[model samples]
Every structure is written in structure tokens, then in C-alpha cells.
Target: MKDASRRVRTEGITGAAVSAVMRDAGLTHGGFYKHFGSKEELLMESLSEAFQEIADRLAQVGEQSKPETAWKAIVKTYLSLEYCDHVEYGCPLPALAPEMARVDKAMKPRIFEELKKYRSRMLPFMPGRRTADKERAFFSIFSTMVGAIEIARMLPEPVMREKVLASARELLLRSF
Candidate 1:
């Protein structure tokens, strides 16, 4: 199951190729069926694990004493080279958001709940905004972070990678 999560995050959940990879890892194809009622269940579990990691990182930052500091930390961490490069082991927003939009209805609620938790953590730090405004800002922030990381991942060269991270850092830090 651990390996399944790792593999799915890194390679995506799909066809015979993934099955072959699992077999090579010495996990029988049937082993997965025994544990999960369906592939969607397995994906949900994997997403939960991924969400836990993001939540833990966010908790480590806490609600900063100065709201600006919180924003700085959020932008820096979310748009960093490390985050961009670690798609499989990192936030699912970049790796899974589009796919999740088309996934099982049950999976949608879990993802929304996880995102809600993140928004809750962030709300205290965003000042003078209505709930709707804050929610919009949160979504905007989330989108920018994910887009920056996605762009970083798409770059073909080391210098381009640095360029993306640096540009994202500059733009995002300004939001703080």
C-alpha cells in the first residue's frame, strides 16, 4: 500500500504499465484488490497520505505572529525548487488537481475537506477580508503556487528551472 501510494503519486494511476511496475516491486496485482474496494479507494487513501504531509508542513509554519510572515513562508515553501521538483512526494494540487476534478464523486469531497482545512489554517493570516474574499484569495494563492511549480517542472534546463523558481518567489513574496 505504501509503495502503491508512492508509485501512483510519481507515475499516476493507470494501466498495464503500472501493474507491471507493481509486479516488479513484488506486490501481487491481486494484493491491491484485497485491500481496496476499488482503485478510487486506493487513490483516495494515497491522496490522504499526501494531504497529511502538506498539513504537517503547514502546521510547522503555524499562524505567524505577523500575518506577512505567514504569507512569506507559504509562498516561499510552496513555490520553492524543492516543492517543484518533488511532485510525487509533495503537494497534490500540482500533481492531481486537474485529474481529481474528473475523479470519483466520493474522492472529490475528501479533497475538498483537505483543502478546507488548509483554508482554515490560512484565514487568520489574511486580514480585513470577508469569508468569500478570503476564500477567493486562498484559491488564488493555491493556484499561483501550483502553477509556478508546474511551470518549474516543465522547464527543460537548469537555468530555466532557476528562473522559474526565482520569478515565482519574487511575485509571490510581494503578496505577503
Candidate 2:
């Protein structure tokens, strides 16, 4: 499942071949069915796992941080150079959301559910006085972070990528 999560984040769904996935998992390609009914099932389940993994990590950060600094910590961590370079271990949004639109229609709801769950998990860490404020902040912060990461991933130079992350980070830090 970890192998599939990394593959889908870095390679996209269609590129995650059963043979390659099985090979990476140190199992025979023919044994794929012993785990998943189909590649779609594997991909969806892996996506869920990816969301859960990142959310849990961020929740831990939120839990450990003071309320006033929680949002800052989460944003800094999200917009850092390390997170920018490591999509395999990063959020599913910037890593896989684009490809998600191209996935089967039936799977869209499941994807949405995972997204909602992720948002809720991270909600407590956002800096806001009210739930409404936090919810609005959620859309702004996450959308900007996702866009920044996606743009940074496209850049060839580390400096340029850092600029993108920094720009978004600064703007968000001030606004939020």
C-alpha cells in the first residue's frame, strides 16, 4: 500500500502498473489479486491511505503546537523545501488532485470524502476565532499551499522553487 501510494503520487494512477507495484512490493505480479480486486480498487485504497497518513502527521503537529503557533507551524512545514521535493511523502492534494479529476466518476465521491476528512483533521490547527472563520481559512490556506507546491514541483532550480514556496508562505502568513 505504501508502494502504491508513492507510485500514484509520483507517477499518477495509470502509470502505476500492477506488475511494477507488485515488483516494488517484493511480491509476484500474479499475486496482485490476492490483495486487490482490481487496479482501481488498489489506487482508491492507496489514495485514502495517503490522505490518512499525511493528516495524521499534521494532526500531531497541531496537537503539539500552541494554538497561536499551530497554524504557522503547519504552514511552514507544508511550504518547506523538504515537503516540496518529497511528493511521495507529502499531501495527496498537490501530488494527486489533478489526476484525480481524470479518475472514474464513481470514485470521485470517495475522493471527496477523503478530502473532507483531511480538512476536518487539519481544522483545529488553523488560526481562527470561530468555526466559520476556520473553515474559510481552510480553503484559502490549503488552496494556496497546494498551488505553491504544484508550481514549485514544476520549477527546475531549487532557488526558484524556494521563491514560490516563500512567496505563498509569506502572503498566507500575513493574511491569516
Candidate 3:
């Protein structure tokens, strides 16, 4: 499952070959169906696992400091070059979102559920006196962070990429 998560995120769900993933996992390509009903099932499960990994990391950040401080740390770590480079093991939201949007109907609900869980994990750290306001803030910050990382990853130059990351991190931190 972990290998699948990494493969799908790094190579993309549609782009990754099932045979290659099976080989990486030390299994025969034919054995894939023994575990997953279909490619969509594998993708949905892999996405769920990736979301859990990210949620765990975010929870740790929230636990390590005050809400605002934790938010800063998360923003810094999330937008860093290391995170951007490590798409396989890092956050799947930025890595898989574009592809997921066009994925099968069966996969969309699973992705949506995982995203809701991810947002719920971050809600406590967001700034808002009301639940609705907090939800709004969380989405705003989360979208900006994800979008910034996605854009940063697209740039061909290292300096430009760093600028985008640093600027986004600065702007987000300042807003909170």
C-alpha cells in the first residue's frame, strides 16, 4: 500500500503502470487483483493512505506548539524544497489533486472523504470563533498552500521555485 501510494503520487495514478508498482512491491502483476478489485480500487486505497500520512504529520505539528506557531511550522515545512522534491512520501494533496479531479467516479468520493478528514485535522489550528468561519479559513489557507506548492513544482528554475515557495510561506504566515 505504501509503495502504491508513493508510485501513484510520484508518477501519477494514470501514468503509473500496475506492473511496475507490483514489481516495486515484490509481487507479480497478476497478484494485484488478489488485493484490489481494480485499478480504481488501488488508487482509492492508496490515496486514503497518503491522506492519513499527511494528517498524522499535521497532527504532530499541531501538538508541538501553540496554534499559530504550529501553523508557521507547517507552512514552512510544507512549502520547503524537500517537501516539493519528495512527492512520493510527502503530501498527496498537491501531488495528486490535478489528476484526481479527472479520475473515475468511484475514486472521486474517496478522495473527497479523505480531503474532508484532512481539513478536519487542521480546523483546530485555524483562526475563527465560529465553525463556519474556521471552515472557511481552513479552506483558504489549505488551498493557497496546495496551489503554491503545485505552482512551485512546475517552475523550471530553482531560484524562481524558491521565490514562489518563500513568498507563499511569508504571505500565509503574515495573514494568520
Best by TM-score: 2
Which candidate has the highest lDDT of all?
2
Cα error, candidate 1, residue 27 (Å): 7.3
User: Residue-wise lDDT of candidate 3 within 1-176, one digit each (tens)?
Assistant: 78878888899988888787667656676778787788777778788888888878877877787865776777777888878777897888899887989987777787888889988888887777788988997888888989988998999888888899899988988886
For residues 28-144, could you state the per-residue lDDT of candidate 1 as single tens digits?
A: 678767766766666666667677777667656645436546656767777777777777667777777777788777777877887777678766554335777767767777777
Q: Report the candidate with higher lDDT, 1 versus 3.
A: 3
- Candidate 3 residue runs with Cα over 4 Å from true position: none
Relative to the unseen true structure, what is the Cα RMSD of model 1? 3.4
Question: By descending TM-score, how would the candidates be arranged?
Answer: 2, 3, 1
Candidate 1 worst ten-residue window by lDDT? 15-24
Consecutive 10-residue window with the lowest summed lDDT within model 3: 21-30
Report how far residue 107 has shifted in candidate 3, in Å: 1.9
Clashing pairs in 1: none
